[model samples]
Target chain A: MVVDKMLYNLGRYVNLLRDAIARPEKFSMYYKETMRQMDAIGVGSVFIVLLISVFIGMVTAVQFVDQLGDSFVPSYYIGYIVRDITIIEMAPTITCLVLAGKVGSNLAAEIGGMRQKEHIDAMEIMGVNTAAYLIMPKIIAAVVVIPMLVAIAAFVSIVGGYVSTVLPGSLSHTEYVLGLRSFFVPRYVFMMFVKAAVFAYLITSVSCYMGYYAKGGSIELGEASTNAVVVSSVLILVFDFLIALLLT
Target chain B: MIRTENITKTFGDNDVLKGISTEFYAGKPNLIIGSSGAGKTVLLKLLIGLFKPTSGKVYYDDVDLFSVDDDALREVRMKLGMLFQGNALFDSMTVGENIRFPMDMFTNRTLGEKEKRVDECLEMVNMEGINDRFPSEVSGGMQKRVGIARAMVLEPKYLFCDEPNSGLDPKTAILIDELICDLTNRNNITTVINTHDMNSVMGIGDNIVLLKDGHLVWQGDKSQVLESEEAVLQDFIFASPFLRRLREDALKQRHAHD
Candidate 1:
């Protein structure tokens, strides 16, 4: 019974996305909405992403320093480890996981509110494709902007590693820099962006789906928002593993 | 005109609308009225293609609403405008933006032209200016007016209002009814209103369909209301003892005068 219900929902979700990912009625209207979404999803999330990324780097460097005590592994390996972990995994995965909580829930609530308030019905009556108008721009904005955020997270985490280690005199500046310079693979950056894009798609599409078909009242809307975040977070992790396995 | 032929709807085991056939003529305000759970809303939604009937057909003029393709349905929908019970104005947008949204989505009209039409719609609703105000900043009555303005902004040929007077002062409700009546007559448009407000029923119900327990029990104009011998209509419109006494007194007076 549970599997049947899941399949039913999956079918509905796919149909809803099929409607949403159609050719837009007008370019200018979609462009204007996409830019607004870009501002909200990209610019609005910068501070939290930056704050979390900094802490992520700091904790990684500090923990590595403690573990490397009196070991034959050189001190600079801290920089190498932090740089690789951040680039290969932490930046895209952690940043997007946090965004799933923040932006995903918000998107779900917004669309769900519209549904409850009859705005979607009104638009449908007006000949506007409600699914396309509501969801497409959000998807576009997240796709375009989330990868950029992931890139910034990568850079910031490395800087955080430098600040935590070299500034505290736990490791010399030159050694840390040397460690960062070593074992730098361009393919890892490509993998980070690929993960970022895939996660962005997952978070936005799932959240929009939760909101679009949401029924009942405020309680249902709250559940939809919670589901958006939880579902997106889980999907992000699952996809992260899949992408890592495929790309590696 | 819009016509439904034996339309019915069922949700789970509950049959909300049981085989209703009716016609809503243009150039007048057609009303769907009934007691709570009478399937008035369900019938209205069916007429508008928002809900598909279990076994029936809806014809918008000559076009079958259910048999049409999506593009054809969309083409039909382009001529439709609806005012929801909650008004359904976008809270984030100014009144002007809400009004212009349909035009923005479907038309290539210039901004100047769209603004002019927006102002004209607002004026038609007797709410000139106030375009910059968000929906949250306005009173409930003002929101209804804004909703009407947005609905009529595209000059739709078919207008559907679901309980347009649901939460408003009597005076405001009358004003809205009058505005809707005038617009219907002036534009020769099909206006279908689902309402339970007695003032609206007796005031502007050019044609009325009454539903009871998913069956359309009575159909007539306001003039036929007091004179009709349908027990269901009698019990519905004069459910209160005071009103029933008044109805009996009026009937006696009419007979005596005759």
Candidate 2:
């Protein structure tokens, strides 16, 4: 029964995406909305993304240094480990997970509030395609902006590794820099971007779907917001695994 | 003009609207009045094509509403306007922007032209200036007026209002009724209003449809309301003791005169 329900929702969610991506009634209106969403989703999220990335890099460096002590592995391997983990895993996955909580819940609450207030119905009666007008800009903005945020997270995490290891006299600056420059696979960057874009799409689309079909009053709106975050987070993890399998 | 034929709506095992047919005409306030759970809102939504009936045909003049393709439905909807029960003005937009939004979406008019139309709509609703204020900055009555302004910004051919007077004081409710009545007459547009307010019924109800438990119990105008002997109508309109006593006094006066 649960599988059946999930399949039904998946079909509905795909149909909604098709409707939402239809040509806009007015290009300028859509552009303006997209710009607003970009500012809200991208610019509003930088501080927290930066804060988390720094901590992740610091923790990974210190833990690896302790594990490699008195072992055959060189101390500089900490830089290489931090760089690859930050780029391929921590940056895309953790940033999107955080965004699923912040932006996903926010999008759900905003759209669900509009539904409960009858704003969507009013726009529909006015001949506006409510689905396209409300959801498309959000999806487009997130797809464009989240990858950039993940890139920034990768760079900041590398800097955090240098700060935690080199500055603390555990590894020389020159040795750490050599480790960072050593196994530079361009395909890993491609893999990182793929994960970022896929995770971005999953989070925004899932959140918007939950909100668009929201019914009832304040309690129902809260439930929709919660569902948006939970579903998007779970989908992010699932897609993360799939993208790693396919792209690698 | 809008007309429905044998409309029925069923949700699960609950039938919210039994086979009911009605007409809403142009240039008058056509009121749908009934008690709670009388299916007034469901019927209104069906009329607006928001909810499809289980079986029925709704015609806007000669166009069958439920029988059209998506593009045709959108074209038809462009001629329609609705004011929701909660006065669903966009909270993020200022008063001016809310009124200008439909124009922005549908019309190719220049900014100057759209701004001029926005001003005209605000003036029609007697809310001159204060265009930059967001919806949250306004009172409930002001928000209702803004909703009306937004609905009429396009000069729509058909206007539907759902419980327009629900949260207003009696005086403000009467004013809103008068405003809607005046707009319907001035535009010569088909206007349908769903309400349970007796004041609105008495003030602007050129035609009224009464429903009870999904059944169309009676249909009449304000003039006929006092004289009709329909038990459901009497029980609904004169539900309170004070209003029932007033009805008895009016009957006694009429009897003495006769």
The per-candidate TM-score of the B chain, in the order shown, comes to 0.98, 0.98
| C-alpha DockQ of every model | 0.85, 0.88
lDDT of 1 by residue, A7-57 (tens): 998999999988987778888999999999999999999999999999999
Provide the TM-score for each candidate, comma-separated.
0.99, 0.98
**Top model number, TM-score:** 1
Clashing pairs for model 2 are none
Tell me the interface RMSD of every candidate, in Å: 0.8, 0.6
Give the C-alpha lDDT of model 1: 0.93
> Between which residue pairs do clashes occur in model 1?
none
